[model samples]
Target: MKSLNKVLLGSATLLAAITLAACGKSSSDSTTSDSKTVSGTVKLWVDTTKVPYYKTIVKDFNKEYPDVKVTVTQSPNGSANAKTDVGKDPSKAADVFEVANDQLGSMANQGYINPLSPAATKAVKKNNVAVASEAVTWDGKMYGYPTSQQAQTLYYNKAKLSADDVKTWAGLTAKGVVATDFTNAYNFYPVFLSAGTYLYGKNGETLKGTDANTAAGVAAMTWFAQQKSNKGVMQTSNALNQLKSGNAAATLDGPWDSANIKKILGDDFAVAPYPTINVGGKDVQMQAFLGVGCFAVNSNTATKNQKAAATLAQYVTNKKSQLVVYKHSGAIPVDKAAQASSTVASDPVAKAVITMSQEGYSTIMPKMTQMATFWNLSAPLINGAYTGSIPAAQYQAKLDTFVSAISKAN
Candidate 1:
């Protein structure tokens, strides 16, 4: 349950290509005089899975600000581009929108959103991870308020492996555990991070490649391939079946899987960070794949509407609302104060994600424009090397081809 049930390279494709599919989740608020009635048609767009929980938070907010009557609406799942399309016109615009980190570049480039003022930016800066803020910033201006954040970590069944036993990928395999639908490209993320290899060069946002294709990267990829591909020790045909049927016991993933995992395993579930990798003769830390979801105000909203939207966004992202949102959605709260709450801080999985988010060098998932071009071939090529379909020496050439394909497409 802690592992994702499905792997959508397609979503990753959208992310890398700089095109977003839109979902129609909507929220509303109204203005008033007596008691400061907060009534207006506030528009919102979010995934369906989050709509119900979002409604609860909106309801609670309405209770506190009764004068502001609010409405909530659900969006079709996996349609981020459609949401962006509506944002083009005020008639169909959402007062506030939820854009995934991967799609931020496109959304920002289209000028559909407004940047946060210095005051609001400072507020978010005080509590949020610097990377989270940076992910939503473009051209040195902040445009979004992060609502939730996450990074990769290990989740295991306590009944199956001791935390100490589940610390490393090798250990997890020893316990007869494996990843759920993880491609070699995805699985190697931890090792690359631990090795301090990033997909793009951090200097001036240049993406010319890095040591991620190095011997260390290949070694790590080969190790995982041996477990899942060669040794037959790890389950290859969907790791979730292994978890659901008790065939597998440990896996790596993020908070997105928490709620379902809780339902499947109950209290037997345990969480830990990725096992350390060797770097420079030292035990390096786990590399986490970090991403975030944020709220942005429309650039076209009137100054009055913009101010009100900003206020509403801040209120919803505040500690109490974050608690409600995280509890219901299984999302990592963006507020530092919320991270300290017993409910969040006590969870080992949440803790591991936070630990990684804090120390981990967060990177942008490729903007949508490059996804399919890079990943469609990248995953296959990387998997081929690990599975012995391609020679190890050819790794750099294969990677170069994929990168060239995607870069040219972009």
Candidate 2:
């Protein structure tokens, strides 16, 4: 992995340098190395899970722009006061912070972020699409640049079903081979969504909890309960391992798993968009939670520093960097032009992921008070239902009511 990271960096040295140097600083400072050099450091906070990828990006960035140093800090996502620590002290805050997009709305509302000015708007708009930019905008204001895209997909072992064989859920089930990481929040949502059910509804512009207790919704939930037998027959494990090995015939997953599938299953893998269902005579699409790892400017910073932070954010998410992100990291490039490359379209793994991303829509991950606690409760509850210990009708009634009450208060 280290050698692969270095190879990617060396291949793109000049491009990385040009990108980092162009992001202006919010304040002017003297540089002893060269008078014309930009002089300032950008403190970046990233989730520790992503440190491996970011380290390479940072190393290559530093080589090109020695005048602009980036201090990369890793903080665990589980830290109790992580957000509070950054929110309270500008001195301790990262000039660029990457958090889940569901948290972006509340944080931006709290005055924690600086709004993207016209320059950023132009830069991102030219490179990305409205769907890719979804998470970065709140209340009509753009605040972040999208880092990657995800969509639910039905990944199958080509040995089991060709592209022509398993096109629908019935075909999938008839094969008596289907599995999922029934434990994960994002991956399981597709099973429910494929049955024409949803956790929330948009009443005009406002999002409201609805349809969770409806007949169709309960039936969808029941289908998942029935899948436990299928799970056992298919030899289920965690989605990563299950899909990586060719033991499981099919599993629902996101674009992030594309490379791992290739690494594990080799040439025997294929992916297709999850099937749809008719709701009220209209075909409603499944909505997964979309998020962005954005470069955020600290609002508390001096104006000059803030401006520079914005520039860095823009450059890092530009077409060139996005290409690197797509090629090496296996992340879907936010830049639409990057998708047009023959390399992206011709590569089997990338082709499957790009197709899924293009057709997908996303819901915001829940971030209100007690939301994490609710997840704690929901995971086991949902798992128990999937494993058939809990009856679907009874479980749905209890779970829906509990979640509704929690949503109201939180």
Best by TM-score: 1
Model 2 misplacement above 4 A: 1-39, 47-67, 75-90, 196-200, 203-207, 231-235, 239-246, 276-288, 302-304, 358-374, 393-396
The residue-by-residue lDDT of candidate 1 on 1-410, one tens digit each, is 11111111000000000111122112222111222333444566656667787778777666655544455555433324433554457445666666665555555556565556555666678876566677666656666677777676777788988877766555666665655544545554445556555564552134464445665655544543454352424636465557778877766667777666766677787777777654534466657556666766655554444444545565666777778877776677767778788998887767877776765533455444454354566567645755667676666666556546654525
**Per-model TM-score on C-alpha atoms:** 0.79, 0.76
lDDT of 2 by residue, 284-403 (tens): 454444434455566665444543454455556666666666676666665667667776667655565455544344444433444445456555655666777777548667657745
lDDT value, residue 9 of candidate 1: 8
Q: What's the lDDT for candidate 2?
A: 0.53
lDDT score of residue 230 within candidate 1: 29
lDDT of 1 at 268: 87
Tell how far residue 9 is off in model 1, in angstroms. Answer: 17
